[model samples]
Target: MTHLSGGPALPQERRLVTAVPGPKSLELLARKNAAVAAGVGVTLPVFVTRAGGGVLEDVDGNSLIDFGSGIAVASVGNSAEAVVRRATEQLEAFTHTCFMVTPYEGYVEVAERLAELTPGDHPKKSALFNSGAEAVENAVKIARAHTRRTAVVVFDHGYHGRTNLTMALTAKNMPYKQGFGPFAPEVYRVPLAYPFRWKGDAQACAAEAAEAAIDQITKQIGAENVAAVIIEPIAGEGGFIEPAKGFLPRIAEFAKANGIVFVADEIQTGFCRTGQWFACEDEGIVPDLITTAKGIAGGLPLAAVTGRAEIMDAAHSGGLGGTYGGNPVACAAALGSIETMKELDLPARARRIEEIMKPRLAALMDKYDVIGEVRGRGAMIAVELVASGTRDGAKEPDAATAAAVAKACHAAGLVVLTCGTYGNVLRFLPPLVIGEDLLNEGLDIIESAFAGR
Candidate 1:
């Protein structure tokens, strides 16, 4: 089936013509290793020639069922009709006039739409940027400007971004923060309501974790000294950990009471990926500021810091923009992305994905001891792998097994990803437009991998 783009559709099936990194791809990988920096990483080295719907065609004639969605950046498909049309028209009109130098209507329209579509009904404003990290840094800047405080609070196992300050804000050490230190100061981390890992009853962990976090903030870092409390409604790179229910509301309340800006890092969970415009809406938690990217502009680079008008305007007039902050093409793509989302009812599609995925994953838990737990919301689903599935005790994380399963799936022409603080969670993020047949085929590959078939 053609996507709304009505573009040349790639076959939405897993077709393995040869081994995964087929000869052509291996040659490309060799060239890449020589040309690319070692610091940058690649998940699957299969050189993609074209992609559409739910499949990506590698140069070696392999059709892989895409579950990563280019790390959730292509949720409306790689070429949604609206996104292509709007961006093409804008590209033809002008590639770059520098929005700051000669402002365009596209930028203004995107900002206006962000205000209308984001969580709260309060008067909101937005500043666009080139990437998620930029949006996050700007959010912190705006929060500090508004609150007149130095300390910024984040949570454990939360992944924000890769910029210097974001690296300090991130909790992971190996790839994200290792050797990147003497980092930015005044960034503090408290406990997340991580239900699966909590020592106490998972249900009770919500209220307790919130209290513990609040206590730490009050005792260690005075509330008056804090500028913002930033968190992900559903922690993304840190294994899609959905904080226990009621946890977010408490933190938001504490931030509100303390005159601190509450920022929701929705880079991964925004758009319709989590069955809603924003994951913060799940519990009626309205953040003071929200940082968004990933699915914001179909597949283009675009991010935004959207928040209450007063908080956003706190930054100096010239403090917020960059030369390429809101490129006309990217802004137009964002408008199309939002349009596709609304017209296709992609949020409902994400919910339907959850309805199909969770049960299949949970059934696997019964069959595979390594599957410790299946958790997440909507299309952003994951299964945590553990060495032991004891009836009553902590499960040992099995990152090796997770990696092996992912490799096996890759060989079978399915693209999947693994994440977590321990790196033992296998996460799936198929495009919202993926057909049910392809989705089932991808899941079948996963099940077969587990069965060693």
Candidate 2:
């Protein structure tokens, strides 16, 4: 393998032989559409045949630089050497026994690693699950069990998951919660510190908003009835919104004083996606419970809840676990992914991605009156679009502009994804191992698309 200054060298620059959903991808898509559920959203039409580091090759002989990283699941890069090797070796030995039933070294090893790597020097424990939503639901269960409280508080624009309880925790309605609710009860929503739109000093605004939210919660539901306050250090699906500098620390203090559990849902922001092992560390706030998924196990479905020992122990003997939770194969992948992350210093690489993206996005904001804001931490970044010239004039995002730019990027051989409540934000979650040349090429496509060139 070729080596670059920090990591492996990129194979080559992007090349497109046909339309994005070229003949091969279109043919496979037609077959997939016939059998797969329509509700499953497909971001780009291109079908990947091979991928490594930062590039995805389609069956139609097109190479596209991946900026989405399979929705932040490939932080170590697609087909990471360590992950592939470990997974293959584990496949040769064993696949599944269900950690709860049979127990295994891999499962225990991963749990121990999590406890060590997660924030806080206190005694911590971890439990593995199948997805971010499961970890979130379990976190609530543990919090409630420990505090003997009923209500759980979540913030606006915070995305927990799609499960019933998490659905209630989530803020966006359409697609996620739209015809699917009769959502679980005992969940409440509060306003978050969105600095871009709010007026005042960033830190003061965050502290005041958090204090007001706590006051509202106490006045309305009473802290005695509350179980936990869940938040994303940097809101992921919620347009990559980063809480103001002092926001997380203030919230952590409020939770501590009120005897409420603080849950950090790091599903998208974890595993070095945000230039740190955990985004909460940026503010030096140690959450009582932290939910993780996305990049934990390379591309495997493994989620975890790591937190204080007392709280986690509150659950009954059989209260936490699942049939496929902590599958051995997935555990192996997680081990490899974590090892690769440390050995290669992916967090520093993530900072490099931020360094590269910030200026390009800033240029876009300067050139396009339609671009409203560019925000995020490290490689987990997003650009929000608004109709030209409007402060309070219909703050609704421009979905059409987002869709047009995404389509143009695809046509020009770049893979991108759109997010946000109004679908007006373009999020970039490129693998930390991405090559500089390929990343710049993808950014160029974004610029060209915005310029309507």
Candidate 2 local lDDT, 352-410, one digit each (tens) = 99999999999989888788888998999899888877623555578899899999998
Per-candidate count of clashing residue pairs (backbone under 3 Å) = 1, 0
Q: By TM-score, how accurate is candidate 2?
A: 0.96
Candidate 2 — which pairs collide? Answer: none
Root-mean-square deviation per candidate: 1.1, 2.0
Residue pairs with clashing backbones, model 1: 5-81
What stretches of model 1 exceed 4 Å from their correct place? 1-5
- Model 2 ranges with Cα > 4 A deviation: 1-10, 199-204, 391-396
lDDT leader: 1
The estimated TM-scores of all candidates read: 0.98, 0.96
lDDT for position 90 in model 1: 92
